[model samples]
Target chain A: MLRINNLHVKIEGKQILNGLDLTVNAGEVHAIMGPNGSGKSTLSHVLAGREGYEVTDGQVLFNAENLLQLSPEQRAHKGVFLAMQYPVELPGVNNMTFIRESINAIRRARGQDEFNTLEFLQLIREKAAQLQLDEKLLKRNVNAGFSGGEKKRNEVLQMAMLEPQLAILDETDSGLDIDALRVIAQGVNSLRSAERSIILVTHYQRLLEYIQPDFVHVLVNGRIVRSGDKQLALTLEQKGYNWIIEEDAA
Target chain B: MKSPVQNAQLQTPQQRQQLQREWFQQLVVGAEVDAEYDPDWLLPLREKALQSISTLPLLNRKQEAWRYNRVDNIFQNSFDPLFDNDLEQKICIEDIGLPAIDSYRLVFINGRIDLSLSELSELPAGVILTGTAEALRTIPDQLMSSFDHLHQPGEQLFTALNTALFNDGVYLHVNQSVTLDRPVEIIYLNNNLTRSEQHVGSMIQTRNIIDLESGASATVIEHFISNNKHEKYFHNNFTDINLADDSRLRHYRIQDESRLAYHLSNVQITQHRRSRYFSTCLAFGGLWSKSAVRVEFQAQQAECDLLGLYTVGDQQLTDFHLDVQHRVPSCRSSEQFKGILYGRGRAVFDGRILVDRQAQHSDAALTNDNLLLVRDAEVNTKPQLEIYADDVKCSHGTTVGRLDPEQLFYMRSRGIAEHSARKMLCQGFATDIIESFELQQLRDYASEKIAHTLNSVESEMEHKNGH
Candidate 1:
């Protein structure tokens, strides 16, 4: 349940998202694939309410509310999750403690009971097991010395814990190894439900083979130039963004 | 504590020399050695100290060690001897909250050892834990011989004054080869309720010369606390540690004075062949606190671990000046000092590591990191490495910065308030030093104190804004 009409976004007074229109119904996984500078990441960040992305001329409607007006944390509390392309490394914040606090904060804001230490430990064990993550990583400082693959796994683990109503995965496959990519895709697949919608933004079609997005939209020059079913991803992989670029030019 | 001795007024060179002559005569009279206790072997040292005291002018800010420190106040206060009495003799050991240590316990109320509550019964034979005043009367030869061995009088105003007028102190002597597992706890309480001037001068001389006999290890914790929250207080103290061959010593100092108290202490340590010395200093409270540590690696294969943590708030000031000297070859020293400044508080750290000319293959390191939480809070950090040997690995680094904005934003974005985020980041900056403490109870207590102080400042600011 998300809708954007004529979403024209400008960052630093430079137009990024120009008259873009997109909608994703609940239970649908939408893949927005594009070349560099196509506003793919900008769309995800704008929806997630990151600062400095001035909404010059657009409205993002999520569950009949203006998502742009909410602060980043408020947006998070309202079930808007953004799995950043590069997760920030917080040196002293323990991974488990941070995840627990984040979940509890959102839950408290949403009028839910908070999890105690034992409950939190149990919850993290279950989630980590689901992601096939090492339990030892949960005790370390958040991504202090984590490898590239480990960081992506951590983000997916958080997404599972937060269980956002609408999830936006930005370039989640950018730095993942083949095995890590499979594990991460599996984690994301397990979290899919009829009540939750996920917007997968990527430049590679490798991750599409696993999570299997329902709709594939080719983004060119900050606009969705083509929309098709899952086979669109296969065609784009067989041929490349160059064909779409030439077709858009014609 | 009473005011320390003021120096002669600055004058012309001719006038200064004349003042020096007069001060020398006065110092000789003031330093009249006790009869029947003076050692012939220590005669040269006493004479040298007398001459140094007379010739060496009081420390001025011009000296690199005292560069950022306010020595003018010390120069304005004249030395006033403190008299010990039962008026302030009350001390609840439970309130002190010291970890249980083996061996006798001696409590110093305003610098005089409280022998009534001391447990001297468990001390090994020939081990002494008595007042210096009485020790001099009983064994004058031993006390005089070791006095000023590690420290010279008059070199530092406080140390010189201590030598001239130390009425009472703790004299701990571990018999040779005594493998004492228990550490002696010396609690110096500076409660300024005595109505008398508070000038605390106590020297701890450990001569156990524990020739660890090749593999013996012992840990000693020396605690200094001044909870007095009033004016008219001074703490001028010194500690001289002499470790024999193959011996190990762990020294810990906890100095938490009130906002109106002054803390000045000198720690001089000398290590023999293969002797290990470790120091952990935690100074969390004081209006004006300054400490100097001079460690000499007198023999080869010696190791020293120097760690310190100081947290200041309000207009409080804390200064730490340390010199890790590598006199012999193959010595190693690792130093780390972290400080947090809030309110209008200020902190200064001048750490110097000196590698002697012949002391090759020495590894020395010094690091000082400071975090400023408020605009008015200030930190002056200087890490100096004086290396005369080319083969030594000597590195010094100093960093003074505020909390990371990105980290702060991340924490706040998690719904943790801005104040909580700042406090957590500040605590994280100090955790490196706090984690070094082996005692979990002390570590937890220190962490809580630091966090509480940080939050207190934040709340006070919030309240002021609310008004």
Candidate 2:
């Protein structure tokens, strides 16, 4: 469903990603594990087409279409989703109104009919209920004054609303408690299907205990140094990335 | 409305002072309290004001004009007008948050003009962009004549007070058939921080006069700002504009002062035959700000457009009194004023347009709308149209409303677009007026400031709710 080849990214003239390669097929769940400053978030941001990043040498393909040439909104229209590490606070803008506009814009770009008001309300309410987010929270500004757990769940709620084909959850478990982790994992589990793929990017192996991944890749220095099955996560949790770094150095 | 006190040939300061002394002695005004700080030319006017008030009848409830006004509202104030802070240190134009656009820039801090910060040395020929002090020295007769149509001292005491003690302001005159290539920016920054601790409030009175001769055109932006956040002061500003036949003037004003300041402003504009006047006023600051705008159409084929936007929050009050008069036939005028009230903010808008019987074929429309963001906020708006012309088309409308509860209840949207959301929020109410601004940078800056204010109010509300 997605491919990244020789992705070398730099931010403000400092290289972050160096010759990274990764590929995921349909219905595959991949767990990308790395320590701090290991370019894990960089991969997610690059895929989402955020500005201020210079991709000196890289190629990204989504469904065999060049993704680097598209704008951020165009990437979203093509079913590329990045659950941000820190969801931005948008004051004054109504949360629901923004979501509706985003959905309609993407739908319009995809040549699909926009959702009716009543239909949209019903759909959003059902999805929000499944994630255990209060209906009152849906009324507030997007990510404005939201708690850490609430922010994670809100990201999950948006993911459910957009229903993208390739969803990358970036550091979703970084600040969440166990209950929030379980709720988010459950939401992701329910959305998984034969045609949908998910990339769970994290620094710890705790999130994998809730939702099992088919593949585990340890990314160090912008490149995947090791790839194995779900058992690889357990092994890395026992022996931290320090040993892996030493191994890479050796 | 022209005054009959027409005198000329007082060419020097001493000559004008002598003439004022002669007039003062002839008036036989006896009620004199200390006048050491008063200027020679203004002493006579102040005494004339006192004489006019002393000759008035006692106040009565039956009097329509005095029905609601207290004597103290006009004549009472503790603010001193003698806090002269001669700050010679020049500051950059960008330090005040105004873009350094290519224009004639005038900067005044503490009522004193800063030549180092001003860019008026290279004005085009036939254009005069100067301070009121220089104008008084050069064209005292013309400057005083511009205010001939103003209300008498007994009628509007604040205006008379301004005339009696106006420190400094802008004076721009475009000669016949001349067109200014760029707009003139007059920035007034009142920051008497040294006296704020002493509980002494300084009074800042500024008067501006703009004259456009026949077939002349110019644009002027008057910006009032306060540097210290907790500055305590009183600002009274009066502006007079005159457009001759076939002349045009676009006047834009912005008042973003400290919340602890009290502000009063009056703008009087007169349009002659076939002249055009466009005014955009944004009132976003000051604890208690009151503005009165009057536009008069004196001849046929004249047009005027008035646009105002005001936002008040948290113990703030903003009042606007708009009056438009169409005295000639085939004249046109339209006015739109919008307000945003949040967090116990109070706003009052009283707009009135009068079309005389001689003003046949006059087209006029006035609308005032207010958006209340909180239940505790208040907005009182009234738009009145009194048309005596049978062949005129006049309509007036006013609305005081809140944000849609039903729409705000559905804030959980699909993944959001921050830029689009902010634009949409500002577009909901402010787009109409902000878009009408002909300057691109000014429009964009206003939009960004509105967004910043919205965020601040929202966060403040959240903190209140949290407590």
- What digit string (tens of lDDT, one per residue) describes model 1 on residues A34-137? 99999999998788666678887878899989988877678788888888787877766678878887888888988999999999888889999988889999
| Candidate number of the best TM-score | 1
Residue B411 of model 2, lDDT score = 23
Q: What is the TM-score of chain A in candidate 2?
A: 0.98
Candidate 2 chain B worst ten-residue window by lDDT: B1-10
lDDT for model 1:
0.75
* Residue-by-residue lDDT tens digits, candidate 2, B1-467: 11112233323534444433433222223212334644456567756655543343433324333332222222222355544566566456688787557789888886667777788877889998888777777777767666664472123645655665576678899999999999999898886444633544567777888999999999888888888777767787888889999999998989898987878888888899999999899999887787888888998999999999999888787888888899899999999999887668788887879899899999999999888777888887877788898998888889887654223322212323433443355445776788788999889878877887888776676687894
In candidate 1, list every pair of residues with a backbone clash: B1-B198, B1-B199, B1-B233, B1-B234, B2-B198, B2-B199, B5-B79, B154-B160
Residue range A111-210, candidate 2, lDDT tens digits:
9999999988999999999999998888887777999989888888888988999999999998988998999999999989889899999999999999
User: TM-scores of the models, in the given order?
Assistant: 0.85, 0.60
Clashes of each: 8, 7
Clashing pairs in 2: A95-B411, A95-B413, A96-B411, A96-B412, A96-B413, A99-B413, A99-B414
Q: Give the worst 10-residue stretch by lDDT in candidate 1 chain A.
A: A86-95
lDDT of each: 0.75, 0.78
List candidate 1 segments past 4 Å from native. A1-24, A42-71, A217-228, A242-250, B1-55, B73-80, B96-104, B117-121, B124-131, B149-155, B194-216, B413-415, B464-467
